[model samples]
Target: MPYLLLIFVVLFYAGNILTGKAMNDLPPFTIAFFRLLVAFIFLLPIGIKSAWKARNTFREYKGPFLIMTLTGVTFFNTFIYGALQFTTASNVSVLETVIPVVTVVLSALIVKEKLPLIKWTGVALSFLGAVWVVMDGRLLELFSSSWNVGDVIMIGAISCWAIYSIVVKQYMHLFPAYGVLLVMTGMSVLILLPFVAVEWTIGSVPSLGEVKYWIGFLYLGVFPSVIALVFYNRAVERLGASQASVFLNFLPVVTMIGAYVWLGETIKLPEIAGAFIVIAGVILTTRAGTRKKRKSLNYKKTSYN
Candidate 1:
């Protein structure tokens, strides 16, 4: 059942790319702000009382919440939207597959989690696959010309997400999930206000009258922000973070298929091969970590006995 929820989670997230790419005409920051506004509104009725009661708790742990808001809510989707402006959504999703490997490295660096060598090799494989996708299967072209700015921006996006994941693992379990999301969404809306205002002032405004744009807006706000988050949290509770994250390896595959069918984006040979490699690497990395964790837990149980 948790795995089923996770499949939906990946699907909803893939929908984010498809919808966001479709509405690339809107200013990226503007899109982000509105998306958060919609999510805030949707979550308010359900989470407001809880959030109000936990206001002091949030303030007490303002540092982590602030970081979470900035990294996960504010800039991550903004970067994805911005990247879509310069590259295909498929490329964006492919690059995002590196997040798990990056998160593993960050885990080791920041939390001092000791990983075995095989996991490090998985990291290397994932990077190689990501590079292959980024260069569009033309490895030699990397030397001749600069990579797409969109791809570079995706690095920021993934880094923000990886950091956000680590922080959540470290601190967020103490808070009510929905309430925390509400507060963080509210925070993101405020943090993004200035940039959105700038976009408005500069006349990069969204077409408020367009039905398609509104559909995209609501889709982003509801699916990825609310529903997927709820389901993903539940899945994590059931499956554990590492196990749940392994499902994300399917993200690129889903996004590519969606991009092709919905947006008529070409599914090239390199993308296919690269996505396979990245998924293989991520599975290896995450499974290794999970196995090691299980071993440690077993060792602790033995000592206790």
Candidate 2:
């Protein structure tokens, strides 16, 4: 059942890529601002009650909350949307599979969490696969070929997400999940508002009259922002973060299929092979982490008894 919910989560996230590409006419900041604004509005009614109940938690953890909102809500999708402007959706999706691996690395560096040898191996594999895809399998042309700016931007996107994931794992359990998300989304909307105004001054404002743009915004706001996140939080509670994130290995597959079917984008050999490698690496890394966690739990239980 948790797996089923996670599947839907990835599906919704994949739709984010499709819709982001389709809505490329809109400025990235504009899309991010309004999409989050819509989500904030949609979540306000339910989240408000829980938020009030947990007001003390919010007040106590303002720093963590601010970090969560800035990295996860504000910067993540905006980076994705910005990357979408310069890269193929398939490329972006493939690169995004690096998140779990990157998160593990960050966990080790920032939190001083020790990674097992197998986990490090998995990280190396994932990194290699990501670079392979970015280079379009032409590793021989390493220094000579021009890289896609959007693909480079994806690195920042993944880094923001990696930081966000760590913060969530460390602190999100202290607050009501939906309530926290509501506050975060609202914060993101506010943070992006000034940027959107600046963007408008540069003639990057979206056309408000287009039905298609609204449809895209609705999909982005409702599915990826709200529903996927809600379902993902539940899945994480049920399955544990490592186990649940293992399912994201399929995200690239879903996105690539959507890209081919909807946008008529071609999936090249390098991308397919690199995606396979990345999936393998993510599975290895996440499974290794989960096993380590289980071992630690058993050790504590033994010591307690």
Candidate 3:
């Protein structure tokens, strides 16, 4: 069932790609705000009790919690919705998989995490693959083709994801996943409110009366925002983040099929090849590492002092 849950996590993540495509008319900030607000409303009942019980958790780890919530819940989706305004879902999925590479590189520089030669090689390969996809497989396009705003925006989103993942690993012990999610969801809603207000002023926010927009909004609010988090927390509990992320390699493939089916997106060979290359690099980076005893990341350490 762990394997199945991993697949479910990927599916729900793929749903985000579809959701973004479906809400093309809505302002990115508006969509992001609504998605978080709806998800926060639903998730509060499930996790708020834990958060209340652990109310001091916030006081203790205020800095980390603030940073985590801002990066993961706030800025990440902000850029994702922004990116969808200009690029294809296939490109988004393929590019987003580079999160690990971004994390690894950042860790190395920020925290001085050392990487073996093989992992370094993987990093290089993954970057090249990302460039290949961004340029539609031809390096010459780097010079000839104008860069897509969506692609550039997605890099910002991916960077936020990377930072969030690192912060989670460092401080996940402070609260249960549910409790942590509750806090983050609330923070995201609050942080996004001002932006939503601005979008409303600009008249870019879409009306909620449209059925298609409701479907897209509801799906994102529920599936990716709520369901994916539960499944991912469970997977991380069973398989450590490094092992769990291997399953994320299937993300692009799933997104490709989902994009084709839901968004009527056409896949290109270069995009496919680039995705494969990126996944291959990820596998090399993660799989080549030294082995350790099987220890689940229960992350139940008491709140920090």
Candidate 4:
């Protein structure tokens, strides 16, 4: 599981690098559209087979399935990609680390999940770490022109993702994960088609001359979007959402590495420190949740057996 998660982190960083490269050639939405489009093409066969096998289940979940696809694939990806246009990869990645915090708060409010004190502390620490990283340790710079519109867009994107995560956790028990992903990918592709068409009409279509662009597209479609998601769902199924969220703490580190190698971007000391704090907080939060889950399981077993 650790090895799989490590690979997921690597791919996640690769996706960030790829987005950085592609954002130059195309608008964020167009780039996102194509990324999903490629994944849709690759998974269409499997999705079709799965849909056929689970036709009855799909019929029963038409409404929920639609909502899940819209939120997860369409809204989340579109917003993130668009936000990338205005933000630095480092800023975006660090901010994204707060997604679990958003998810936790939303879960508490919407699903009535109670957070332990330790976990709440961890969440607070993680959020502070994210802020530090976003500000690059120059606390005062946060309010300066050094911050751009992209940062604001990223916050909005994070909110969309947090909402999407909660919605999936709420509805996934009703349908298979792959089935839901397949449907969502398909629907997202359809939603973006007209946008892609408009972009093509307005200007010449983006070319694939640069090797980096193709590499980025392939990495985004196959790894982060497709393969990483498979691993994520499996991890969530086995470990539960609260536990699985800790792994996302690794995302910023991986992204930083990718940025350095692929984009030749330099990382400052504060960024490194912030990443560590975020990871520590994530660990604490997950450990707290695990203990809670065990106690609940023990209570249920005592009552039933």
Candidate 5:
């Protein structure tokens, strides 16, 4: 179930980049504001009902709410949209491949996550493969051409997602994903409102009347903002954030396909090779970790008996 959700999330997020690639007319914060506002509206009724039922639980975990608001709502998309204005979506997607590693490492540091050696090696290999594609067979060029301003900002954005996923994992069952989405979207709207206002003052507002902008706007609100998060949060619930994050390593594959279809970009051989390598690493790490976990669980049960 969660795997299916991640597939939908991958496709929706591909659209996020595709739309963001061409949303030069809108300020990043402003676009985030609109996206969250529309999402909040769409989820209001159902979300309100669910949240109402969970009011006491929501209050009990205000800390999680705040963390979710900050990480998921606060600036992830703002930073991503900001980066998209300055780099190709494909390039941005390449940069995003670092996120699963970020999530894993952060989970280790922040949550004391432990993994087998093979899984760790898989993580490292996946990163090398992503860098392989980004550097186009010249690994040395990675050091030389790695940190454009946009790519650096994107790092910050994906970091936000990493943190958000960690928090989501912590509260996977404690907080309902639906209510979390509502509250996070609502908080994000509040958070980005002033920033969007600043952009509006600076003549950086989007053309709300433009049909193309509307299409992007609606797609973002409906698909990535609302639907994707539901799927993503559920994946976090079922798989744990660190495991769910491995799925994100596949983003570039979806982005590459979407880019070709929507933006008429051509796929490259390096990207294909990198995509396969990343998938290989994801499979190795996840499968090995699961097997180890099952072994441990069986040992514990036998000892108890």
Candidate 6:
């Protein structure tokens, strides 16, 4: 289980780095549209089978399914890719480490999941750590020239993903992950079609000759979109949402390493410190939830007796 989670982290991080690199050769929307289009194509058969077996359940979950598709597949991917065009991979990576914190808060509000004080404190610390990394510790200079439009877009992307995570946990009991993911990807592709058309009309289609771009696209579609989704849903099924979320802390670390290896980007001290703080905060928050769950179980048993 731990090894699978680690693979998920590595693949997702690689996906983000590939996404960042793709931005140099292809427009963000184009990449976002096609990556999902490919995912839809690839997963269509599985979705059909799941829907065939559980048609009634599919109808019942239509709303949540649409919401997940729109937020997770369409909005999240578009914003992240777009942000990559305007920001450094490091900035995008560091900013994204806050998703776990956002996921926890959203889960509490949406599903009435009880969070402990330690988790709340951890969320705060992790958030500050992400902000520190983004600001490079100059705190007050956050909105200065140092900040780019990409940073804002990435923040929005992170929020979308956080919401997606919460919604997935809330609805997983009502629908199978394969069905949910397929529907989400299908809807995202549909939503992106018009934009893709516009870009095509403008002659913005990516060149097939660019081997690197194709490799990135293939990696994004296969590992990050499809394989990662499977692993993530499985983890969520086994561990529950809050516990599963801890895996997200490794995203920036993997991304940083990928950037250094592939893009030859330098690793700075601030990024390392920020990553550590973020990981610590995630651990604290996750453990807090574990403690709360034990207490609740105990209370239930006592009340029943």
Candidate 3 lDDT over 136-160, as tens digits, reads 6887766775669998999898878
The count of residue-pair clashes in candidate 5 stands at 0
Query: Model 4, range 145-198, lDDT digits (tens) per residue?
Result: 555787777777678767766666666666655665676787788888888888
Q: For candidate 5, what's the RMSD? A: 2.0
RMSD of candidates 1 onward, in order? 2.9, 3.1, 5.6, 2.9, 2.0, 3.1
Work out the TM-score per prediction. Answer: 0.86, 0.85, 0.82, 0.86, 0.92, 0.84
Query: Candidate 1's C-alpha lDDT?
Result: 0.80
Candidate 2 TM-score to native: 0.85
Over the full model, what C-alpha lDDT does candidate 2 score relative to the true structure? 0.80
Candidate 2, clashing residue pairs?
Answer: none
TM-score, predicted candidate 6 vs. hidden true structure = 0.84
Task: Rank candidates, TM-score, best first.
Answer: 5, 4, 1, 2, 6, 3
Between candidates 4 and 5, the one scoring higher on TM-score is 5
User: Residue 267 of candidate 2: its Cα lDDT?
Assistant: 79
* Model 1 RMSD in angstroms: 2.9
Looking at candidate 4, the ten consecutive residues that score lowest on lDDT are: 2-11
User: Candidate 3 local accuracy as lDDT?
Assistant: 0.74
Tell me which residue pairs clash in candidate 6: none
* lDDT tens per residue, model 5, 232-293: 98888877777777777677778878878877878888877988887888788778767887
Show how many residue pairs clash in every candidate, following the order shown.
Answer: 0, 0, 0, 0, 0, 0
**Residues forming the 10-long window of minimal summed lDDT in candidate 2:** 238-247
Candidate 6 segments whose C-alpha is farther than 4 A from its true place: 2-7, 45-47, 134-140, 143-146, 237-247, 294-305
Which lDDT values do the candidates have, in the order given?
0.80, 0.80, 0.74, 0.70, 0.81, 0.72
**Model 1 over residues 65-84: C-alpha lDDT tens digits?**
88978888889999999999
